[model samples]
Target: MNTKMLHDSICRRQSIQNDYERIKSSGSEANSDDDDHEPEVNVCRISAIGLFVNKFVEGCFLSMIMGRNILYPFFGIYLNAAGNSFNSIPAVFATIWATKIFSAIFSDALPLFGKRRLPYMVIGWIIAASFLFSACLHEYPEPYYGVTNCTRNTSLVLNPRASESAFFYVLSLSGALFGVGIATVATDALTVEYAKREPLKTRDKVLAYLNIAQFFGALFATILSGFGLNSTEYGGSWCTSYIDFEDILLIYGVLCVVCTFFTLTATHEFPVDPKKLMPIKDHLAGIWKTVQSSMFLKMAVYIFLSGCFADVQSSASVKIKAYYAGVQPITTGIVGALNSFLVIGSIVIFTKYFSNTDWRKVTIFIKINIILLTAFAQLITIFDVVRNQYFYLLADETSCTLFLGILIYIAINLSAELSNESQEATTYGLLATIRLLTNPISTAIGNSVSAPFDVVSNDRYIRDTKEDQWSIAYAIIATHVVNSVSVLTVYYFLPKNKFELNELKLQSTHSKKKGLVFVGVISVVFVLAITLIMLSAVPQTQCLQVVGGQGCSNKN
Candidate 1:
């Protein structure tokens, strides 16, 4: 038979085989006590392989996210000193963002090489693990040094001697690999595929479950790193500790290897001929066409703004810690865990209440609430900055920040649902790309403006204060304000009636329209509140200094 005919035959056989297996499995449970009731003799062994493949793929995804989150805090702490330089912290993030963009660019081409998702997943994880392991080799001895503080508790400054540039190169490369593995291609494709499969009726639920898995994985990583690695030490410093950087990388590497083995042994790949796979250019063109849709374009904008705002929060962690002076690493870990936990809970709650509701309205509602929440949170931080009393407000800021994160999470999920099923992977990939671009651009801009104030400012400016603390707070608030406005503008200009908003409502679905209207009014109130807070609570000159001494001087 010809190639096309052979392919058709294989497809037919697969369909028949799948149906037969389904029928056989459906009846087997009824005869649990009958040992003689044999399973279908001719049923393809591929089905069993497929089940394992799916589970392994899922595990790989879980491990990737968990490993990355677990590694981030440690990596950040390791590179914290670099923040004093040309702001290497943002460069680390930019590495991640750049890798994601590259992943987006290339993920669609995987099929052309007769490869499936599993290989990319495996290779990406392995590369990540290898690069991470390299970070440990950079460890060198730090000579003991002393510090003197009159009022506060003073301790020794045991700074690690600078490892070779290759160490940082490995660190950044590992981050890029991790980003490529989890954020760019593999995870997104897996999500879309799973959504297309089981629990056929509720694809959104499938997507939500994926996010739930990610949240738990991230939480686990954070807890383990915080309590397991950071808490234990060979001495006071992480470099000299027993659970040092290399050990962590080794553990992460082992996990990735396990994930790879599981994926290879168990994951299922659909039977598609390599000859029939579309060309990379064609696939990309298809993606371009799908992104041209107005809804997809709006969704892209939403993702971009949301990602920018979220990155702003991430970029502010050092400042938040400094503000609390003497805060434990686990304290930051707890905040991170809480953020993920609340985000998961919010997604569940929103999904429950908005069941079967039109996705567009849900998306709009989430976008509005996220913008408002973020704006309010930024204002709160601004107030704390002015008062120079941020510690008291940490709990509130954490909760509110998590809530905003949840809203953005929901928005992205809803955008995934809004896209056509056939083009789901491509559409979501494009959205991820947009997020990747926005995050780095916003981060770069924030870091650029804030870095000068952080590194160059005279000590007398704030009675002998480190400019780093003030710079962080300023960057966070400024980025949030910009992102919030961008999101609001996108929502306001979005087409109102492209998709029926009422279709999202189930019998139990809450009045999303009312909720949206309420959120909209509240958003306006929050924006106004933020304006007031900026004007009243924060000194204008302080704000100007924070904004890199720009002309917006309200300093009294």
Candidate 2:
């Protein structure tokens, strides 16, 4: 019996080796399913999006979205109606956007009442809700109470009340922005842990789906802000029901209550051991080390350069669209809603089809796509053939924003890999903070470039002459070209592909203190510059010179 068993085992092994050699020689594929077995279902599956299906996940998602997007289409619309330059209102508060870093740092370093994220989130939401509700109490100056029609009377926007209203408006917005920062920190920290636990090959897809909750919140907010508030102030309402302060208040007020409820109930966290906690200085030092590492330094350089140059856009584009292109408020709302819808779709496509695509190639394609779209949009202003305002629609802000979201998704994936399990929030916070801080810098740089252009003067749009159109169009074209070139300047920074990126597991010994310091100094200066421009944007300031245009009122 022993002799028979030994002989059988030897024959089986020989036959298996022969089959392996045959398959290798023939270049045939033999996957696990060669025997017709099905792939096992994993938690990372897209159907696990869990919005309606999973209540716990939905709560955290709601909190994340509220702070990030609750004030989208309508807020800008109100600013326009009230004759305030968004440049002034938003620029000063650019630092608020970067509160993600602070939020993460505090959450990691000093737990509130011995808890990490929950106490901070609850308190933060309450503060945010208070500020927003207070803002609702005081309506935008009477000029903006009802929908204002597009006319040459840019002076209506110059009312002294406009400046006062803008001041309060920005204060409330800043407070609200601060509150949501904690929400993002908590949610992102959770998401990062989940992504790390997933299998490496499917990690990106898992992270992408988890982020859909944020996108869905954005979609919901966009639809409400756009479809509900058809009164863009520049254009007439498309629906019989126009959005006033009350409606805007109600939507956001309800949003706050729901988000608060979710945050209070849905989130779960393990208690931290007091003895296990690291000092704040040590935690920060770890992050600084990562920042000085080779991979992160490269990405930081690219973010600084590209964010400053490539994404610059004049705030005046809104005024141009409304009065020059004859784009109605309803039209703006429709476009916003469409863009939000496409953002969700873009993420889905990126995860499903291009998850394994070359990171460098994907970056190149999206950057080029943005440049082309921008160039074409500018050309819409120059050419008479496609001068129809609706043709401006074909310029496709959707594609530019859509690709931008995918690019951010890729960056987040890469950033997660560079992070250590201990310093996850720190790594993410610093990177995201740099990204946020750059927007104001880019805006300031673009505004400086646009200093000579009459994109927003009363004389330019009110006169409505071909000369004004050509000059503004030409100026934008020049800026577009400059931005497009800058995109090419940072191509060397991104890793070539996934294989190379994953191989960078060793910590870099060299520290980039000087470069980091220089970047930090420049960041402060530009943020201040943008903030100052908005602060001095009162009507008396004469030619405000921000994205909103030459003055507080669209006037000279």
Estimate, for each residue in 131-240, the C-alpha lDDT of model 2 and write its tens digit. 77888788556433243353323445544344346567667767766776676575566566566654455667656765666656555555555555554342444534
Candidate that would win on TM-score? 2
RMSD values, in order shown: 11.8, 9.7
Q: Each candidate's TM vs. the true structure?
A: 0.64, 0.79
lDDT of 2 at 82: 24
Superposition TM-score, candidate 2 onto the true structure: 0.79
